[model samples]
Target: MAPDPLRSATTTDDTAAIGRLGAVLAARGRPGPVALGPHGPHLVTSVADTRRVLTDAEVFRFPVDVTRRATTGEHAMVARLRPEQVARGTRTFEAELSRATTGWDGGGADDAMEVLRLPVARSTTDAVLGPLETMCRDHVADLVLDWVDSLAPIIAATRPPRRWSRARREERRARTALERSLEDLRVEQPTVSAVELAAGVQVPIAAGAWLLVLLAQHPQAAAAARRHDLAVEVAWETLRLRPPTWVTARMTARSVSLERGTLPAHAVVLVSPLLLGHLPDLLPSGSAGPEVFDPQRWVGGDVRPGSWLPFGAGPHACPGRSLGLAQLTALARWAADRHVVLTEPARIDQTRGIFPSPALLRCGAVPSSPEE
Candidate 1:
């Protein structure tokens, strides 16, 4: 029989492939790690094993060659943004988001992906570039967005595109443009800034977009989010349900013994936050199943919000996690009282990290008072 398009790992729709993979892994009955194919990466489904893979840098190392054009010395140049930098970025993000949504009140449908770009990009640039003039900051932000856009095809392809292919050429063009623009700014480390800005902006945009879509889809959850105290919970739930960085991979530096089996040297290991989020053992005990989107499950706080490692874990975890969460929480608060409804169903786009395709929402004011 022919392979099912949705379940085939080689299917062009990466989103379906991932969804099918998760379902298959979950169907294995126990939370044990499993190999994908004869030589494919070992998929770590259990929280314990996932954590072990992420934390044990010695055994499982990051595949630095994730992309075709790998750079050296970049890691040495990158540093986490200071507290003050995060604060500045948060302020900028809130302000930019407000500006972007000014006319959204009861307005026609707006594409969440399109509307979220400026806020995320500008805020990331502010945090990384640090104290740039307004005009210069916006220019750099635009360049960063352009570069990120150009990288989609290159990053999504199963195999690296030919160096001279249009995808590669476009990616190079985008990267060069952003790098040159950053260099002109005389930033402390232009290359580092470029990397930081791209990493910071792209993920947050996908996350914020997902948050909006979830809120729109779950009216009860959206209503609960109106309470300032519940806004963070709403953000957590969004990440739980639809984390943008759903699946990540690490390479085994040497043979490692797992609870289920031993992986040989130079094997690839996969950890999926999306799959882990579905595990009942890892979530708060509740009447609603793990598949349900109930933010109230976290009210008692018995279980932590990040057990599934939405932003990842250990040293290599996302540096902008705090800022990313803050941005999502702010978006949740903004969406709380609004009657935001999806214009159509959102299909997952897995080209570069999973994101909602055409996450279009129509916004209107909710009733001020409940009807008697």
Candidate 2:
């Protein structure tokens, strides 16, 4: 079967091939808006077009109803966090990853998703909720994962599930569990709401898990990370290839002119960070090899990151982006410090956000040098 652009972006074992496919589509199609499917939304293909859509909130409003319902209100929060708070969260992430992975000795394989689950869950919980008793934090973490998992089917469905449907029922149950757990925390910190906490907790888990999967698939990048120099670059490279929230949708509040044609009002506009990452114009010259996992390309810093907007853009952009990057960077470093090898092929799971399911890996801790 020929590549499906959406699936190629969302579910792929070979990123390079899929990226090539995206590039071809971008080049051959009209420079402006392109129809995604027979009757699906229109996709904005160019970086300039994407930025315009994300920034011009007056013309392109966030499809809040779609995102909020798919995520069960967890996507509602958008509080901007300070640098100090993000630093603290980074510390939490580092500590949790070290503790969670310390027991691994490369003696057997472990599921990357399972290994990252508790560490990411706890780190995000601590970052947003502050220090709490182990029991309370763990309880909240479990609830957040439950809510995140339940929303997966709702997001993947072609049509929204009915109120009485099993998917909706499960999502409601999970959200209730999370809200109940947040009650006490909300009372203590009224300004920092539970919705904010949920957003912080859920996204990191998915992103962190993807970080591990990428490291396992690309041993060279993983080795660079272990050397203690490429953690940030590794994280950025991974985000470029496999952003968790790969596609974001917006509704055209009013008619908007584009390079190719005019978009009608109320038209659903699709902007995919994954697709943008594959665009040659937005990348460093001669470094447009989107299929390869090469962190060294970021060394010179000629090509600015965030052009793809992995965490999104404009007023509704992710407030936790810095924190998310810090957390993923820490994970990259941790993976670098170990000799991680993939135990099985990783496949993309697109039930909600994109992540590598069954990302089984094995690792042995890197011995410290005498100089250290």
Candidate 3:
């Protein structure tokens, strides 16, 4: 096979390493899975293989945590988020975001990631934490955000930090604090609630920030999305181009034979929605091509939005998928009419899950609503 042209591009841009990796993999012109190294850790790029690797838990297992072995035997359960909860969360996010952006007047720039943290945290808290006094709910939401922040260093490290390291210590402190708070509230399964709140709050904040950055970069799409229906389409396109959870990993439970090749036991396997989103066959053909951002390709609904598995697929898929989509759609609607402009070039931050770094934007004056 010929060397991919994107290989050079990948090396030059440190910020977009993950994205460039996906691009290079997609450009290889292979119809099957590709290996990252001769020894193993293969990349599953094709749609069928991606689905098979993620959906088959027996053969491909989630990475085992030796520290959590005590709870490993418990059957993992995913709580189904109710429709009413999603609706309530969406409303809460919109209101919170409106409050967060109140002072913008195109006079100064704001970091999208920083601006979005509390609103996303509070919105997710309201949806998942159940009824509580307003003050109590807000306090819990704040604690969750603190816990999420403390986790960044631990997650971004090349290897697991030592138990006594500063990163690990900070994370332990945050987790203990949040767990105690949840217990005080009489929440069932405090450990589970902590995990849910962290996942629910953190992922959406990254997603929402990306939506704003993409909107600011693509004014034409933003203008078209002024219509509510088009805004929803824009949300789908943002997720397609840059799903926060861009890559996921699974370990082979035992030696297995796949259509493409054979893998030894305990080999690490990877699946990436980012790479799948770049495949021409998986997306609708457009004048601009799959690599370009064009929301109109989804107009006729010819190709389903999630064929690339943005939120993932199968039994282990994100349980808060509906609420996450609703939150992003609401954000798209809010940004549609606003003249949001980037103050600086946004770089991809892949230390943890991918997010926009220094996602600074200047907003124009808000237009009065139709009812106003």
Cα-based TM-score, every candidate: 0.89, 0.84, 0.89
Per-residue CA lDDT of candidate 3, range 293-359, in tens?
6677788755788899998888878889899998988888778757788888777777766788878
Candidate 3 residues lying further than 4 Å off, grouped into runs, are 1-15, 18-28, 64-75, 227-229, 366-372
For residues 1-372, write the lDDT of model 2, one tens digit per residue: 123223433345445334323433454335658776565588887877888888787788666553245322123345677787787778877877778877675678888677777777777777777677888888888887787678778877877888889998998888777776677666454324555656676667777777776666656556655664888888887788778777778888788897667988888888888777766665677663665667766877667877778888877787888888998888876776676767776666766656776777788765453121
- The Cα RMSD of model 1 versus the native structure comes to 4.9
In terms of lDDT, model 2 sits at 0.70
At residue 308, candidate 1 shows an lDDT of 90
For lDDT, the strongest prediction is: 1
* Candidate order by decreasing lDDT: 1, 3, 2
Candidates' RMSD to native: 4.9, 5.0, 4.8
Error at 133, model 1, angstroms: 1.0
- Using TM-score as the yardstick, the better of models 1 and 2 is 1
lDDT of 1 by residue, 255-309 (tens): 9888777888888788888778878877786536676777777887578998999
* Candidate 1 error regions (>4 Å): 1-29, 64-77, 368-372
For each predicted model, how many residue pairs clash, with residues at least 3 apart or on different chains? 0, 2, 0
